[model samples]
Target chain A: SQQGEEDPQALSIQEGENATMNCSYKTSINNLQWYRQNSGRGLVHLILIRSNEREKHSGRLRVTLDTSKKSSSLLITASRAADTASYFCATVDRAGYSTLTFGKGTMLLVSP
Target chain B: EPEVTQTPSHQVTQMGQEVILRCVPISNHLYFYWYRQILGQKVEFLVSFYNNEISEKSEIFDDQFSVERPDGSNFTLKIRSTKLEDSAMYFCASSEALRETQYFGPGTRLLVL
Candidate 1:
């Protein structure tokens, strides 16, 4: 079973607009990481935020995690056409190992 | 910029036949993992391997599934008997250490007839 669920299954935005996707998990997590999948290709790790941290940033991407709320959000600032892809949130449980449980994912479409 | 690599971008097999999905992880990585995604579904974890043994596995990984690091660079997942329900995109991932970031391969699309 999947531990996390993402909201706004699909999102469409114009270039330079920001895109936000939210995810919620059911159990306690050690960390949450976001990944991007381009069509039929592999997943690319974007950002990872530990349970102790609330927010993290990488390039134009920003992620905020709220353990109290059991949710997390990924924000892409100044989106571009190339940024169109499926975004997934995976949670690593507090089970001592790093095995991840992923969400259904949010499909983002950036129009030029 | 080393990355994980999977073989035979696509594979087709009969329902009762055995199939082995192969992967070559980053040279120095210690942990390996396998995940699958049915069309229009979330990615699901199958198993995680470290120190030449399985560290963890999901309920989906039943008796039909097995993982092996047969050689220095090759990690393989063998399905003793494939089933129609097994058709999905199988991904291979590896991490340099436990509880760290993982790198994934392009994935192998398997079709069971």
Candidate 2:
């Protein structure tokens, strides 16, 4: 069973706009990580936010985690056509299990 | 800047045949994992390996699936008897330690007929 669920299954925006995707999980986690997948290719790790952290930034990527709400959000600012891809949120539970439980993912389409 | 690498980007096999999906994880990494994503579906965790043994696995990783680290760098996923439902993209990932961020490979698209 999937522990996390993402909102806005699909999003379309023009290039240079900001894209935001939200994910909610049901269990306590040690950390939450975001990844990007291009079409049928592999996933690229974007960023990871630990439970104690509220926000993190890596280049154009920003991730915010709200442990109280059991949710997190990924924001890609000034999106580009190259930024178009499926974004997934994976949670590593506090049980010390290294496996990541991924969400269904949100597909973002950036049109140039 | 090192990344995980997978071989045979695409593979096709008949049902009941055996297939081996190979991966070379980042050097110096200790934990390795396997994941699968069916077309139009979310990625699912298959198994995790550490210290040359299975650490954890999901129900989807039944007896048909097995993992091995033949040497120090290569991690492989072998399916004993492939099924049509097995057609999906298999991904291999590695991390420096438990609970750390995992680096993913390009993935192998397996198509079982």
Candidate 3:
């Protein structure tokens, strides 16, 4: 598996439902971040969780990181139709370059 | 809120032609990067620039590719000769610090024929 790989390549849910996506990495990282991409658009930073931090939240989005297992999960609560997009997990290498290694993203479709 | 901005949202060029994609990173950001995503594929990092020099670049950023910070606000990615495989969405991102959140611009779609 690559350094950053997201499982459940695609997901579908209804409005107000919760969507959870998981990401697993293979090496040490300075931090892990989540990004959202609408169809044919650019990426938007959602949240960042440092390797030493267990969990972090921003409004309806919650992100948890487990350095022990080298895995992270993003949970979007009360998902709205606007939340329908592809969610990607990117890891910042601990080498201090700040380059982002991204995963194969999970496409979430929230239907009204 | 400030955001990175890219020019010519879309571009099409001949395979052997040169293309220069331009970006204006957030004014106050210090670090800048370029990434690309082939349709339906994962986003891949191309290069990172700081202090008017390339800090690190991926293997994909080969001899044909070059980056320049011509002035204070503009960062440009120039491809001396493009290939069909070069067709992808190129994104420009900037951050305040090395480990900080990187804000991305609405990518520029390049199609090489």
TM-score, first chain, each model: 0.96, 0.97, 0.97
Which is the leading candidate under lDDT?
3
Q: Per-residue lDDT for B1-113 in model 1, tens only? A: 89899998999999999999999999999999999999888899999999999999999999999999998999999999999999999999999987778889999999999
The value of fnat for model 2 is 0.94
lDDT of candidate 1 at residue B64, scale 0 to 100: 100
Clashes of each: 0, 0, 0
Candidate 3 lDDT over residue span A11-66, tens digit each: 99999999999999998999999999999799999999998899999999999999
iRMSD, model 1, in Å: 0.8
Model 1: what TM-score for its first chain? 0.96
Which residue pairs overlap in candidate 2's backbone? Answer: none
Clashing pairs in 1: none
Question: Each model's TM-score, in the order given?
Answer: 0.97, 0.98, 0.99
Sort every candidate by lDDT, greatest first.
Answer: 3, 2, 1
Pitting candidate 1 against candidate 3, the one with the higher DockQ is 3
Per-residue lDDT tens digits for candidate 3, residues B17-56, read 9999999999999999999999999999999999999999
* DockQ scores for all predicted structures: 0.84, 0.94, 0.92
Instruction: State the displacement of the C-alpha of residue B25, model 1, in Å, after optimal TM-score superposition.
Output: 0.9
For residues A1-112, write the lDDT of model 2, one tens digit per residue.
4588998899999999999999999999999999999998999999989999999999999899999999999999999999999999999999868989999999999999
